[model samples]
Structure formats: C-alpha cells, structure tokens
Target: MESRRTAVILPGRSYGAYVPQLFFPMLAAQRRGAEVRALDWKRLEELDTIKLDKIARWVSTQVAPVLKDCDPASTVVIGKSLGSYAAPLVARYGLPAIWVTPVLISQDVVDGIKDCAAPRLIVGGSADPVWDADQAFQLSDRVVEIPDADHGLMVDDLARSAAGLGKLATGAEHFLDSIGWTTS
Candidate 1:
C-alpha cells in the first residue's frame, strides 16, 4: 500500500495558519488528498531573543516531532515569514516546499532554500521589504512575484490583493502538479 501524502503548514509570526495566505494553500493541499498539519506556535515571544542563525534550529525543534514518521517522498512543507525559518529543516528532509513571503533577509533561510534539492515554489511581493526578486529567482526556478504586494502579499487596493492571493493559490497548485503530487 502507498503511504499518504502529508503537507505541513507553518504560519508567520503574526500570520496564523487560518489567514488567507496560508489558509488557501492549505485548502489546496487538502483538496489534493494530502493530510494537512498546521502548526500553532505557543512561544512566539521566545523568537525575539533568539539569534538569526539559530532561528532555523529552533524552528526545527518545534517541527521535528510533527514530521517524525513522515515520508519525505510524500511530504511537502508550506511556510510563511517566520515559519520560513524552517527552511533548514525542510532542506534536511529534502521535501518539496512552498515558501510564501519567506524571510530573504536571513542568510540561514536563504541558504537553506538554496541547498534544498527538492522541487520548490517561492511566492513573494516586490513591495515587501524582505523580498528580493533576484534572490528568489536564484533560490528556485518556480517563483511568483506580485507587482505591488506587501509581506502579506496585500496591496493598497483590497480587490487587487484578493486577486494576488488567487494568483498565489494557482501558482501553488501548478507547482504541486509539476512535482507529481495530486489527489490520491
């Protein structure tokens, strides 16, 4: 019997898994018949005190348990902002990833994404302070850069932001399909 596919959803510092950015992709994963695991950080306050390079390790500690028995071949990780700190762990597991508005400012995060060999998709907005189009393209061939969206991929106009969100979801679906992960 084949193992079930799994998708782990990691939210940003302020953006919980239920938020539009993370929620829609999660729904897509579920729709594709993957078991979904959304993480809720209980000790967010501890992050402020941690060093930049060490943050990935901290994220790993929190995520390791959830991934204990998961098969890398059938697993994917979807993370946003702070949750992007799990890039190192994702790389270590060689799992395909959907990094939404990843923290490009952190060398650790950037390196993690760079080192990962699995198929990945990176989505970010040009308007976001931490988003670098050049680096995003360098990190992954599959990238979606919104013209004027922010960290949350939101723009000044609400309708435009909503449209951007739809674009992101579509990009994610395409990425998953390209990697041969579909409804089972």
Candidate 2:
C-alpha cells in the first residue's frame, strides 16, 4: 500500500489562508497531490500574543486533530507569523515545515525549530521586526530573506512585494524538491 502525503497550513493571527503568501503554497501542495488542510483561527483575537507558551499550546490544540493520523515522514507543515507557534508540534512529529515570517523573538518558537530534525524552509523579511536573518540561517540551510519586506513580506513597492512572493515560491519549490516531495 502506498502512503499518503499531507500538508497542513496554519495562518497567522490576521493572515488567512486566502492571502497570497499562504494561498500560493497551499496551491503548490495541492498540485503536488498532497492532501492540504488549511486551518483558520476563529478566536485569534482572544489569544495573548505575549505569552509564548499559551500561543504554542493553542496552536498545537488546533492542529492536533488535523495531523492525528498523518505520517511524520510524509507530512509537511506550513505556518506564518503567529501560526509559527506550531513549531513545537512540528518538532515533536519530526515533520518538514515552511515557516514564513516566523516569530524569531519567541524562545519557544526558536527552540522548537532547533529541535526539529526534518528539513525546514524559513522565509522572512529584513524589515520585519520579528524576523532575524542570522537566527533563521542558523536554524535552517534553506532560508529566503526578502529585502525591505515587512511581516507580511511586503515591500514599499507593490510590484516588488509581488516579486518577493515569486522568490518565496521558488524557494519553496526548491525545498520541496530537496526533500523529494514530488507530484504524484
């Protein structure tokens, strides 16, 4: 019997799966024949952003059910900003991940990424306060840092931001290929 490939998308507090950053990746995974599950945090406003532990736990709770039966080797997790709190869960499952604008300031988030042994791709912007380029490089060999982009990976120029997204997509594709996740 052939095993299944699963992709879980976790959106940031204000960023939904429909946003360009996530939407494109979701489409990429779907095109690869992986079952994609995009999670929407309905109660995002209620969560305390300052409490790293709480956010991590909440993220895990929300994603637990979706990943319950997934095989770590065949599963890929994609998270952005606040949703990066799921790092611990990804680490625990030893699953590959794409972290966009991850919260580098949070120790929990940093620690989780460090603990995860699977291949990971970290993308962020130089202008984003929460993004630390040096730290990102330390965590993963696959890193994409967009110049002058903010937390949304958007630059002063709309066209430039769009181009940045393109760069992100290319990076993601390369990472997927490196991990041998091909279209079925």
The number of the candidate with the highest lDDT is 1
TM-score of 1: 0.96
Off by over 4 Å in 1: none
lDDT value for model 2: 0.86
lDDT of 2 at 61: 85
**TM per candidate:** 0.96, 0.94
How many angstroms is residue 49 displaced in model 2 relative to the true structure, after the best TM-score fit?
8.5
Looking at model 1, which ten-residue stretch has the lowest summed lDDT? 64-73
The residue pairs that clash in candidate 1, if any, are: none
Backbone clash pairs in model 1 (N, Cα, C under 3 Å; residues 3+ apart or in different chains), count: 0
lDDT of 2 at 50: 38
lDDT per residue for candidate 1 within 59-177, as digits (tens), equals 88898787777788788899999888888888888888999999999898899899999989999999999999999999998999999999999999999999999999999888888
Best by TM-score: 1
